[model samples]
Target: MSTSAPASLTGRTVLVANPSADLYGSDRMMLEAVRGLLKQNSRVIATCSRTGPLVDRLQELGVTVHITEVPVIRKSMLSPRGMLNLARIVMSTFPRMRRLIGAARADIVIANTLTLPFWTLAARSCRRPIIVYVHEAESSLSRAARTLLTAPLGLADGVVFNSETSRIACKAQALERRGKVRVVLNGVQGPATSRPPRDHIEGPARLLFVGRLSPRKGPDLIIDAAALLRSMGIAVTVDLVGDVFPGYEWYEDQLRARVRELHLEGVVRFRGFQSPVWEAIDGADMMIVPSRGDESFGNVVIESLLSARPVIVADHTGLREAASGFESAVRVAPDDPKAVADAVRRVLEDWGHFRAVAMVEAVVAQARLGTDRFHEGFGRAVEELDR
Candidate 1:
């Protein structure tokens, strides 16, 4: 992506408030947003709750970093105990966030996700333009919950949703009424050199799943599908390529237990979170993203397409948006092991045709979902908000 400074961002200080310092999907997108601002010659200041891989990456990019604790709301926080913890975080961090925004003298404040309403509240108090990049679509939540989660958008000067699915689910009608919403598709980095799908298959068709091993992400479904595929006499090896969040270890244990229960322990391999996942993508014959829960957008789906690898993704929400109009990406019913297995079987049966289509679709994905487009969209949003 070109770094030439957009007129609005030139020499302007942009404060970025991200909840986590991990290099996951939303975290990585936040990194891309920072990259775009830096390329445009804008001064960037980034604040995260703690230091992790993302902080290191931001430091490498020369962004001024502050380890500032901030309140990050989650679904679990709907309960009494969770509410108390959230209250404690807000009480402890809101003043710091307000002070940081003032000290930075940021022309505009960018909050990476809606989870951090405290940042928006702080930016509002500082009289800085605020942009909250919405990477979530919590339609599954109760109406009251959705209202509570999105109430912070009322304070934002601009609200950028990663997908239309997210935009609609967020119910940002107030923002919409004010013409403050933009749906910027998530930008993904693909392999540097796109290769055709392997021509000769000498062994079991290698299948890969690349996301958190959480029940929501449905890593266990891959195991179930593998067992189903085996029963159908289709040879395959399943690789689950990401780890769970801190509290989701139980889900991982359940996945392993299921593998043992099915007696396919040897057929499934647990590959912990691998960065620059192009290697795993290259090694696998095909990919499956069977998310059973809400996904704002499926970056992995786009990555698979860009690498010329066929993918099977859930047909709902942003996953559908990401893989739409691409025949190379097979959309299966969410949380269905049989559907996943059938999709895998279809690809293997017509491997040659799907492989060729994958190459063609890769070019289209590059044109439509490339990093440049991602950068351009955010740059435009900033310019509009500044005006």
Candidate 2:
């Protein structure tokens, strides 16, 4: 990796490819990166497989978004039918991608996630420098699946990792060891300094969980912990403030059923998909990130801290890195409702102390995770490719 400062991106035309059209953590970060690139006076053309809210959002940000036939390579792609589907999509989409790149005359191509290897193929044909921003930790992937995901990384001119945990995971795969790998931590626009503190301490301790209500995000575990807290005679209310993915509506249905089965209908409220998530975070006494699966990075964890609310996260993957250096934030074993319940109880028991610590820590964390710094680091990493 080069130690030189980032070269300017002025007048550069860059093409960005993202796997999903949803506004999840990775998608949101990609948008942020594009915004940063635009600020540098670079023209950006973004491509994705599907069309949804993210496409509209990008257009609003002055980005030209193209809905391409690029197949999203996932674990399913390992299956026989999936492999055939992938082959068909790649064969069909390759010519179109080549035309798009030629028309745009892109100076650099950025593939937002590891799942989108098609970008590498397209960029290579155009002879453009490529950057792969890896936001996933393959700890949960099967050996064959992980190989499929990491193999194409070697073809890139540069790779950007959202967290050190993700960087380490990629290194362990032994893929593209020679490429310039840089850890560019995800950034969030933190709340203002004069924001009001959470005041609901005397009555029910309002706990909040914000993320996609999926199995990996552990919305069910949050509900389970809420039940455990109630059974322990703790007065607590959990606000689950995010919706499930399109095909994963069944998981949301299961969560609602679990709330009823545990008789926690009153305690766990499903507040679907709150924008400016700080609004939800601000109303909580403390935040809980009970992720059952390995998280490459925990954006919500940082958001909670920036909101001056202490967070209790699962002690696994990049979440551990997110919660590091903050005494107010607590980490418990992943998938353990008992551990989550205990951590919640501990926060509530010393609510004032934890709240004070959070308020102080928020200032520090906000300075460290600002958008300017993130963009500067990201631009520098990309600029290194030009160097």
What is residue 290's positional error in candidate 2, in angstroms? 1.0
Regions of candidate 2 where Cα sits further than 4 Å from its true position: 1-8, 79-81, 172-179, 192-194
Residue 53, model 2: lDDT of 82
Clashing pairs in 2: none
lDDT of 1 by residue, 252-355 (tens): 89888999999998799999998888888889899999999988889999989999999999999999999999999999999999999999999999999999
How close is every model to the real structure, measured as TM-score?
0.97, 0.94
Residue 203, model 2, lDDT = 77
Off by over 4 Å in 1: 1-4, 79-85
Residue-level lDDT of model 2, residues 163-188, one tens digit each, is 98898777634433554787899997
**Candidate 1 lDDT score at position 325:** 95
* Candidate 2, position 41, lDDT: 70
